[model samples]
Target: MEVATRYARQVAVIGVHSPKFSAERDPANLAAALERHDVAYPVVADPDLTLWNQYAIRAWPTLVAVDARGRVVARHEGEIALPDLLESLRPLRGPDGFVAGDAPEDASGDEPALANTLRYPAGILADAARDLLVIADTGHHRLVVASLDGQIRFTLGDGVPGLVDGTGDRVRFRWPRGMAMLPDGRLAVADTGNHALRLIDLGAHTTETVAGTGEQARHRMSGPGAARETPMASPWAVAWFAGELWVAAAGTHQLLALDLEKGTLRPAAGSGAEGLHDGPLAEAAFAQPSGLAVAGGRLYVAEAESSAIRQVDPATGRVRRLVGRGLFDWGDRDGVGDTVRLQHPLGLAADPDDARPILSIADTYNGRIKRLESETRTVARVFGGGDREQGEMGDEDGVGTAARLRSPAALAVAGDRVFVTDTDNGVVRVGDLATGRMNVLRLEP
Candidate 1:
């Protein structure tokens, strides 16, 4: 987002995408991901890790500044403040610095079209009682509200990627990712690209920024920053449990919580370190925790980069890893306890009707939907399987064998059906909780 915002400032921004998963190496998938993120800058796919190895980069997101003579000036590993970065580039913009190109500074093109069909939808919220389904049409930069039977109703955002607050169509969101319904009839949104949390008042039909200062936080913070004052770094998913809204701050490698009643934001788990460690909330560590779900009294987090599922007890401030071994150990092997394996899972959904806890995981890199039994601590692939292969839309539908999925990013359960955002294919899939049969859902304009 910062790169896109600063593209017109006479500074060159190059996006070097070095994918960790084999599925992401494909040119089509890489293009889809870049488009989904709304990266308007020039980007190159480092499939063979050539660029990464050349630059000696180790982190998933690394920034490097270079002079016109091709000498490295600055390099930062994780998230950083854009204002500070822009300030540092001012000196280079002068006559004695890097030469300006002949191309236009505002390289970003016009906004894309708005349609009922989704493109790279990442998050889903299912209201069973009201029979309403809300999808985060991320690539299109809008939220699609439709009935369970597929009737398009309310559409949030004007389909333009931006950060504007208003009611209904007037409101804008930049790559909104996750959503959680609040007890007060409002929806808490992880407005990811904008680095902020937005609240959607269902009754008032208005949207407002409640958390984050609209800038990504550069460093780790404890509890000093208030709700609207503090900045957030790539908040991926959110869940409402107990009395607060829990956020999976992926870029910061930690879990943050918002005191709904008090309207304050604080770090709830992890110490901003990227690794797999389990202990107290403040002492524990996480690696890109992306998806969050609440079951019973504990919060289940899907650690994306580590391919792990973790359990967090808010009352006792205890954090423990339920599955996955480490950051590098990832595969499709399934077993009990430490033997279980998952490959870069991004979304989780707990079964609300079951007394025994059960979570559905979107194992993205493996192109499968897995089921995790909380009591037994066992992991199994319930649907979809293959080595970085996305099957056809209905190829595995109604077959007793493993169901096929194409980079499923998010899941939502309503009664016996599990709704999935098949991101790579740009469609929604419904899987039966009882039989594991899958089907594609189409939304008409």
Candidate 2:
């Protein structure tokens, strides 16, 4: 993205998106994703993977550089560093060197107005005790605090994409995601795009950078350093467990731990490898673990890439898979143990009142809210997708499966109300567990 912004005139970058899941094949879903990520370049949807076959692409993000004459100049199979990519493109320059063209027009002007205040909200936290609903308004780069009754209480950040820290509207965050309340009542945020963990003092209306160096970590296995000194790769979600902050470092494929009292950061689990391997903490591998929840004295992880749910014992330092088969095994099936399948679930919320270990999952790609019973090892759809065709998602509100959701990214359970971050729809869908109905949360400014 930085490269595209820097050389927008000299280069023409086009994104070719190949669908990985059934829901991703939808044109509306693809457009929402592009807009949520603030994509400025033109992107073509390759629903049938025609471009993948033509380009011989074997990875989700393979970059093929084409010259001015439409000749393939260079190819990168995986994520390439900005400096490395810039160096490789130097060969395309002519003898007189590349000339800068006029600045590109703002593509955002063509986008439709959002239906509500929130735009691509990603993560949510329901504090039933405080009667508060905290939402990670991702695309807007801010945190919204709302009362349980849908009234906006307050907000953090200045609604600008930045990493600056200050008070109230002066503070800034870049696409912040998951959030957890500290023991002292402060809120901790996984400032994803900034690669930092931020602390919000709600009482004082102040925000501070507690962890990360404001730069993406080049090394996946770096840690055991001071909290402010450690460079972190995109920390997607955060959970407070065992008197520490557990971070799903998605970009590095590892779980990180930050001890607030000790002021130190270190790797808690994973081997920095992207796959589905469970065992000892140091040997276990995670594929883009994006969501996290703590319950029953264990930490639950939502692996987006593998479409799997895993549990980690903080005391034993062991990791185990609860559902999903492997990296390539994914769908929308409900059953017991290994028979159950999920399609890129991204958020989890523990049912506080349930004596049995139960979790509410935001099945992002499937556009459904599922309930997972750890004791019985059973998964079932609680909301969205009824008799409708598979992969057909919408924004209609109805009873149970009759309701429709579009790429629900994260959810939070408060009492009997399930607050869902309807990401692609840019709205929060509140579900009634008792009544089996769902409705859009109307935010009052």
Candidate 3:
């Protein structure tokens, strides 16, 4: 993200993707990942590790800077600090050091059908009473309001990317994610890309910033005094429970809570470290928790980087890992406890109709929907493939696993039906929780 912003024209960023898994080799899958990340540069897919061997790269993320004449100038392994990167490029920015080059053709294939409908929708929310559906249209940098029957009601953000507060077309957002409805009929938004929280007043038709300083948080700031003044780092998803808004702050690797009634924000879980350390809230660690579901005083976190499911007890301030083994231990396997594996699961939703508590997972990288019974502690695939099927075309309105979902991201439960943001397909899919039949909901305009 920094490189894309700081060196858009000064440097030509070429992503050499050397895949560790076979599923990452597919062009469509790679394209979806790049698009989800808002990457505009051309990326080379090196599935056979051809580039790895050529570069003699043994580490996962190795940065090598080549001069204008194609001579290797600097090499850094692992995460490089932005300041250090800038210093390394300082000497190479002279007139004789770098030169402008012709722009390369965009290799991202044909435009998806119904590009106007949605582009990589990330967050899904439903109000059964109002028959309303809210989607965080991530790729489009907008919010889409529609009926469960696929009728467009109102659109927010004006389909533009920026941080602006207003109403209707005047309001703007950059890759906004997760949304939670407050008790007073207001919507709290995790404006992920903008590093802020936004509030939408539907009745008044106005939008306002409730949290963050409209900038990314570089340092940790705790307590109520720092909450509104401090910048936030990628608030990915939010949930409202007990008069407080819970946020999955993905970029910061922690959970935050905004007291809606008091209008104060503070960290709720995680210690801003990336790992699986289950313990008290302040000491517990999480690896990029992208989705959250709160129920019965427990917060369910979908840790994307670790491919793990963890639970947090608000009253006790304790966190425990329920599923997934480790960061590198993820595949298309299912079972009980740590034996169950999920690949980069993102969004989670609780089954409202179930007598016993149940959670649905968007096992994103594996392209499947999974279910876990909170009481029995059993995991099973409810839809899509248990194994990765990269090139297979999705069967819309198909029954059971026959109905393929391309990169399902966020889920919203409305009675016995669940709405899935099929990110890769750029459409919303509704699934019957009882029968496991999924059909695409067509949106006009």
Return the top candidate by lDDT: 2
In candidate 3, what are the lDDT values of residues 128-217, reduced to their tens digit?
998888888888788888888878778887666788999886788888889888888999899997889999987676889888887777
Clashing pairs in 3: none
Tens digits of lDDT, candidate 2, 42-127: 89899999999998899877888898788888887765566677777776877765565554553432343232488889988889
Worst 10 residues of 1 by lDDT: 386-395
Q: Give the local distance difference test score of model 3.
A: 0.79
The lDDT values for all models are 0.81, 0.86, 0.79
TM accuracy, model 3: 0.87
Could you give the candidate ranking by TM-score, starting with the highest?
Answer: 2, 1, 3
Q: Which candidate is the best by TM-score?
A: 2
Off by over 4 Å in 2: 93-116, 388-391
lDDT by residue (tens digit), candidate 1, 239-347: 9976888899998898988886687899988999999999999999999999998887789999988899999987787898999889988877778989988888999
For residue 88, model 3's alpha carbon misses the true position, in angstroms, by 5.0
Clashes per prediction? 1, 0, 0
